[model samples]
Target: MVLEENKTSSKAPVGEFNSSDLEVGGVVVYRDRAEVKRMIRVSVKKGENDVVVNQLPSVVDPKSLRVEGEGDAIITDVIYQSKTNYDEKTKGDKKQYDKLQDEIKELVEKEKFLTFKLEVITKQRTILNKFAEQICKFSDSSKEEKADMSEILKSGSVDGVMGFLTAYQDKMSHLDEQWRMHDREKTTLTEQLNVLRKNAQDLNPTTVKDAKTNRCVCISLEAASDTDVVLALSYVVSNASWTPQYDLRVFSNDKTMKVFYYGLIKQSTGEDWLDAKLSLSTANPSIGGSVPELGVQLLKFKQPVVVSKSKRTSHRINYDELMLCSSAIGGGLQEYDPTIEDSCLEELEQKSTGKAIAPIEITTTQVETNWTSVAFNIPRMATIPSDNTEHKVTVTSVGLKPEFEYAIIPRMSSHTYLQAVVKNTSSYALLSGPANVFLDNNFVAKSSLKDVSPSEEFHCSLGVDPSIRLTTIPVKVLRGQSGLISKSVTVDYRHMFEVKNTKQEQVKVTLSEQLPLSTDERIKVHLNDPDVRKVNTPVNLPFGTVTLNSSNNLDWVVNIPTNTTQPITLTYSVEYPPGHVVQGLPKN
Candidate 1:
């Protein structure tokens, strides 16, 4: 006989499970559907013993008894209470175990997914850190890179790693566009700030207009004449945010007189205003009179007068019939007005009080002119009549003016005349007779004069020889009783002289004694050589030695020897007596 049994197994589906056997309470179990379908299977070909059933004693527990059959048998518990207790305990415990196992499996799977997400996030964080580090390094390299880094960093977002990256890219693009738009604005604002700072530095604290202060101006005018007029006007400014450029309009009644525009204060130093003037012919003749009384008005501004692309304003000052006067009364007034004098004094006092002080005064005088006369004694040159050799006649004076303008006139012969006008006044009077003249120690001519005045005239005559010689005429004048008079003028004279070669072979002469000398010394020199003739003294020698020339009548001849290397010695002496020393020295 075959017996059937029902079985239950707690395992996964066959395909889902890895193993078919299972252990429960130290018992290994196989998962098989055939075993579960049948409780026993019998084989009939094999011999099997028959089983007899007997009544068990009441002392044996029926729950512990079991039976073995030749074919598998299904055992049924007779003790239902005990089976029911076992089933209840097993079912409760198994259900709890299965629940715990399912919970652990689910937790493990969740942990694996979390770990994968952590890895991805960590990797992304590392890339971001590296990118930030590279950006920092590049910024530190140069100014250009620093600017680029600023742009990049400004675009970064504070989101999750990948989201932050995408946001950062989008932000970077947006930031680049903003920079292009705002760059010009930012530059303009910066330049304006700099210009404001510079202007503040250059400006002074105290100015014509202040935001938090009040100001006042005082004007005063003085009238010189009754017709002179004066007028003034003023205006009040309020709530001026900036020192605005404005155009001021001036009017007379309803007529527009002038317009003035205020310039930039930064380029200007003072307050800008327009001043005008008008004349009054009559006080009140008619409303539309030809010459009307002067009227004045002012128009202030509250808005800026913008001068585009221009630095200076075009406003100009208008001056109407403005007349300047000096006198107070007219020419028709006859006598001096006492009231006018008092008014003038009062005006002067007021002006003096308003101004500075004046300086002190000192006295002065003029000079007077004094006059004197002068005379000179001239020497006359002797002429040689015998030999056909022409002789030079010269008249020289010692005390005469060295430089004087003179007109020489020959009273004897008007045809062969000589005239010299003495422009220079001297301290001595003129001589009476003819006088000899010598120039550069040579005979020149003779001159004679009767008298000489302040701008007097003198006369002289001369004969010139063939030889040319340089000569200067000298004159001697007497000392006057008056003070010394010096005059600078040109000396004019008609005279000529002959020059002869006096130098010959060297001559040696000896002198015994020195001769008496005078200021005007006339002498004749003779030489031992036949070719040598008489000649005047070459120069004025001092009254000391006689070794330079051989004295012959207070004179000496100088000559040079031909083909002779030896030098010639001339012995001469001079004796100058003490003469009257003229107080005034003659001016040359």
Candidate 2:
């Protein structure tokens, strides 16, 4: 697409070397790279006019550079190169570097002078301390010696001993004040030297190798007529990137939630994007755009190979590495895999530089969805500095109606967990990311959200809910032998669970329990208490409805009344031939 041009009041005179005033007009940040668009308006002559655009980031990919313009101008050719100013010592950055060095040298000299003055004051103070000690010793001497000292002082002083002491006090006070002033000066000089030295280092020769070595674009365009042409230049840079984040605010009373979507951007591209139009995309250009092709598969007979035990090795895939490969193959971020070890994941997260941002209310932005990706246009102009810090911007937020229910697995834990099922109603697609869940203005838990499309539903688990209490009664196992003639064996099992709701309003709970499934051909299993065989067939009880799923798990959906308790009982038995053992049975 052709870039949109902005108008400018300044123009270049004809037949003159003109440097274009390029400003960053827009930036579209992707998963691992960013596309920067610059705009300028310049007047051109009838023939070919050479326009030079300098101060481009060094990380800009020259291959991806493109120039588009409007007005009566035919673009000829563009030359991209790194403009090095290493030899021009009297111009631009070299002069600045020299100035910084001079300032630093001057400050260092002043610092040395202050240090000398402070040393002199310290010596004077030390002499004054010695004189005071001598006078104290004279005052503690015998009366005859004291009298002799007084006579000597009176003979030498024009005033008296008191006047002599006053003079000494005045001199000491003056020295102390001078020392304080010199110390303050020294501190100020040290601070100035630090600042100047830092500035000089930034402008040093290596800076010329890095920062001053800028990418420049020279465009030679032919104008059909003398007119002002608006040019838009775009290029891709690899140093800027963004990742998706989310905030889920749940309202339990209304059964609704608001999902705030954000993009965390980090860029160190050596150029500040000030008040530029910003957009976030889910595309990762680093993995390339070519579709992968598969070769024909050939079948061969299996062969066995033997190896020494000492020479054999085992290689296991790491969770983070596997996830990284999966994300690369998926074209975007992949869903969170719970199979990853929590300790490993937590350690990796702790080591990451990206920090969690506090939640805030935000307005939704405009979204554009395509067949393969989606882009969000920020509503206002964004300013991102060259410092590599996470700058989070609100992409969009949507209010979703959620279905809330409590899930209880008494076999694993007695605590009941609240879960919410939400459907994406907005036009923007949701990428996989970490989400912070807040319940009625209080933070409850942190959950991971999977990639979801518009009109798709996903579930989020809010941590344990203490309002509903659950108790699992101990299971009773009755082992006996039946059919004496055939010598058969039968084992009976019984389980009971108690659920109590303490809330003022009724709550829905899903209680799940596991039952043993026989793998042996001679073993027979039967449900004696609550007979059920078909799936989705509800067995209605006084408190709830029970359903036996294909996984040999019994799920009960119960609506417990306020301040009431409900009890659920499950009974089953296993029949096997004599001298045969049964596994997976409860120990107690």
- Highest lDDT: give the candidate number: 2
lDDT for 461 (candidate 2): 90
Who wins the TM-score comparison?
2
TM-score of each: 0.13, 0.62
Question: Where does model 1 exceed 4 Å of error?
Answer: 1-87, 139-588
Q: What C-alpha lDDT, on a 0 to 100 scale, does residue 167 get in candidate 1? A: 58
Off by over 4 Å in 2: 1-21, 82-213, 286-291, 294-363, 481-489, 517-544, 547-552, 574-583
Write candidate 2's Cα lDDT for 139-192 as tens digits.
567776667656645553435335435566776777788889989888888888
